[model samples]
Target chain A: MVKSIPLTKADVLHLLSEIVDPEIPVVNIQEMGMLRDVLLSGDSCEVLLTPTYNGCPAMGIIEQDILLLLQQHGIPNAKVKLVYAPAWTTDWMSDSTKEKLKHYGIAAPLHSSCVNWLKPDQITVACPNCGSEETLLVSRFGSTACKALYRCNGCKEPFEYFKCH
Target chain B: MTLQEALFNYLLRLGDNALIQGHRLSEWCSKAPVLEEDLALTNMALDQIGAAQAFLKYAGAIENKGRSEDDLAYKRAERQFFNNLMTELPIGDFSFTIAKQLLLSSFEFFLFRGLSQSKDQTIANIAAKTLKEVHYHLAHSRDWCFRLGKGTEVSHEKLQNSVNALWMYTDELFEMGEADEVLMEAGIVFSLKEIKPKWLELVSGILDDANIALPNVDYMQTGSRKGIHTEHLGHLLSEMQFLQRAYPDASW
Candidate 1:
């Protein structure tokens, strides 16, 4: 009889890194920091996820994808739980993913500590296209709930800024 | 009422407030003055709906009933709902919506801040998560109030009228009843008395910045906690509940 090794936490992490966020195709859940923790005991795997935003529509899809990916990896009894403690912040997003987001034409979130949502007018978001600091907020919300719409005064192009929460 | 029952009722009030207000905001999805503003309002609506689901789900669990969030939201009769009267009012115009947002978001900003420290872990968790969204919502409406209040004669008149028209229902926001008192005793809920002063201060500061006068009113509307609502709520419920009423157990 041939014996197969059970999946470890590192193995689970490696698999999760492949699951792309349906909303932002360029970034995976791991890179987005939505995948918080994984507990694997035998074949019963448990995954904990935190939504990037409280009402993020992508949560359901991400949960399903994680389950399917785990199942495909021969862990059929995996459970994905959504938690909201120490709440998910833009600061969790990896630098590489932020670069990928900017390259994808959606300006990534500024570091959480640097964001002052209260004084939005005082905050300057450089345009992804022209790299100009003269972008004006067209709206506090954008195409997605987690982003803000901004128009570049220099480039004269409208773009999405991944807002800090 | 027993402590459990009181807590259940309290949760309904919180959930219903969010659900009804979210429904009203969704009405502006395609009708906003600008596309960006349309998205913003709808996004806020989504946030409220999500919050409502969390609260209602918790309420159902506490009731020890088989009911789910949808069952509580769509299956409840108009009289069974406990949302505030301000939430059921029609979204008359941009300024009207802005005026409503200003009042409710300010109220929620403080309410959630208090609830975040509640003895109940579930309530505290939900409150802490929601407070983040409420912060942005308040800021959005506050800035708009400033812009519209100082924009032009027509804009200022519209906003001022909105404030006056809605002021009658504002008092009911702080009207705590037996359920609230019971929950307050249990530390499951906090007194609105504490939130009232902070609410007034924050709202007044925004109104002052907006150059809008505070409405001078005496006779205030009430009864939402007891499920007594304006005529508008029934109509709103009929439209909102239409889908679930027609196709039971439908899911995407």
Candidate 2:
């Protein structure tokens, strides 16, 4: 058997960049802000991941992806640790990531989730297809925990909105 | 109660409430009034399940037992559960669910806000994460209270009746025991009584706005402190734990 070559923390982080969100396949986990940090110690490495939503089933798959990637790279004793202190926020997502989501037919979060829940009518998301701000709230829940359903009056298309939080 | 015992019991209460409530909400899947509402209820169910997992996992650790979250969840008996009485009641109807959720979410809003500052790091972390999710549940429930409570006369009457029927269980949500007092002294948890006023104010605001009157409950149901639960819990557990019980240690 060939001897395994160890990967540095940076190398592991780079490899993990390829792991995409299982539900929203358009963007990677890193871009979605679920990949928080990576720490290497001696022969063991730990990846810090913050879940998008505490109940998101994608978290289990993300952890499996991290372990699989590490094993493929011959990294030993690597583990994924979920941290919830500061709590994941939409503010961690960049504008480009938002654009990617929009291009994928899902309207990105309009406001930072840092803002508290406002009245349902106050939240106005632009339709990704028609670029019209005449979208109506369909439901606060969508196909996944991270999305909310919306309907665009301009194009009369129902779309998923990446929920702010 | 010792701090360890108090903390463990407190976590059990939190976990059991979420798990039972989630199970009830999940019963609405594919059965809600509409598709969007169906998805919404199940989404809430998913959030509560996740929160329940965290709390139960921590509780198992606190007990220093070999049991995992699944063990605590699937292997436990009805008498071992510590969920609030309100959480275990049968989902009577859409109006009943909306009324119950309004009360439950409002209480959790204040309860979690207080626990977010917990002296224990694990409890604090779980509370903070769950607090974020609770915001949406609270908002949705509050909005529905208005929709059902102030809609047609039939809708308004249904909601009012649900509130009156569920009023007795509401007090159990705030009832305290030895564990609560101990946790409060240790700073691991704040007094449920401390947040009762806030919980009442929030609930009363929605009820008042929706034209639903404050329920005049003469006496409140109790018993979660002693691991006692409604008979509904036994039946719920029987169905929920059937697979695990029938196929012990079965792996997917």
Candidate 3:
């Protein structure tokens, strides 16, 4: 008979790294900085996560995914808690992840959201579709909370810009 | 009031406004003038609901009540609710929704910005996060104000009426309670008096550019902070609370 191994913190981390963001499949939760900490004590386990957006529906899915992955890995006493202290920021997103987002046809943020908000007109975003410098913001909101709709003047294609925030 | 009570009341005000306002915006689903507008309103609704959850959850904890965020949102009566009356009022028209969004989003922008500086770390964190979302909502509605305001005579008239009709409720947004004084003194909350000027300046600036006149009204509608609300809030609560009230503790 095969025996189930008790889940270690390293085991949990390795399993969690496999979980991709439900909305943006290209990036894993680890890459997005959603996985804050995972603690394993005896049979109990707790995972702390920070929300990237206040109303991002992906949070529920991510929580469920975490638990399912843990359960499948032979861990039963596990829970996910959402934390708000210090909040979440696009700055925490890595440059490599931004490149991955651009490859997925969504333009990455051009600057830190903290500094860009006041000088919105001065900030420019290149088109992820055509890589054009001339892109006009179609709307502040697009298909989701974290992205804005933009139209490329060069290619005339509309694409989503993962907003500065 | 003790420090905890003041904070609880303050959080209830924050949560109720977002809860009621988000419901009003959700009504625009499948009904907005355009697909983009539909998405915009609903997106804003989702953000507000998320904010409401955070505030209410904190409020519940502060009150030392076993009530969860869902309980505060779903089980509370209308008079028990403290959302600004303007939020509970019906979604009048496309122009009216835009106008209300402009006013509410702008108020939230300044309000949250001030709150980001709160001495309370949790409130500060939520405010900072919410401010980012409200920034987009404000810009979205502000752009529409320009379009509908300058587009055509009929559109302009509708937009003007919305702005004027909503002016009366604007005063209640800045009303400070004795409880708020407790938090304000402790540096846990910002002064609404300080925010009112910033709100007025932003609102008037947009109205000026949109060619809409600021409403001239002597008597502004107040109360709602203390649970006194318009008749519309009762009706809104009936719809929002129906499923939860019918099936107590029911969950998927």
Among all candidates shown, the one with the greatest lDDT? 1
**Which pairs clash (backbone N, Cα, C closer than 3 Å) in model 3?**
none
Q: What range of 10 consecutive residues in model 2 chain B has the weakest lDDT sum? A: B222-231
**Which is the winner by TM-score between candidate 1 and candidate 2?**
2
Q: Candidate 1: global Cα-lDDT?
A: 0.89
Off by over 4 Å in 1: A1-5, A115-118
Q: In candidate 3, how many Å is residue B188 off?
A: 1.1
Write down the worst ten-residue block by lDDT for model 3 chain B: B32-41
> Which scores higher on DockQ, 2 or 3?
2
* Candidate 1 chain B lDDT trough over 10 residues, lowest sum: B131-140
Candidate 2 wrongly placed segments (more than 4 Å): A1-5, A118-121
Deviation (Å) of B190 in candidate 1: 1.8
Tell me which residue pairs clash in candidate 1.
none
Q: Return the top candidate by TM-score.
A: 2
> Individual DockQ of the candidates?
0.61, 0.70, 0.65
Q: Which tens-of-lDDT digit does each residue in B1-252 have in candidate 3?
A: 899988888999999999999999999999987787788789889999999999999899888879999999999988888889899989999999999999999899989999999999889999998998887888888888999999999999999999999999999999999888999899998789998988999899999999999999998998887899898998999999999999998898
Q: What's the TM for model 3? A: 0.95
Q: What is the C-alpha local distance difference test score of each model? A: 0.89, 0.88, 0.88
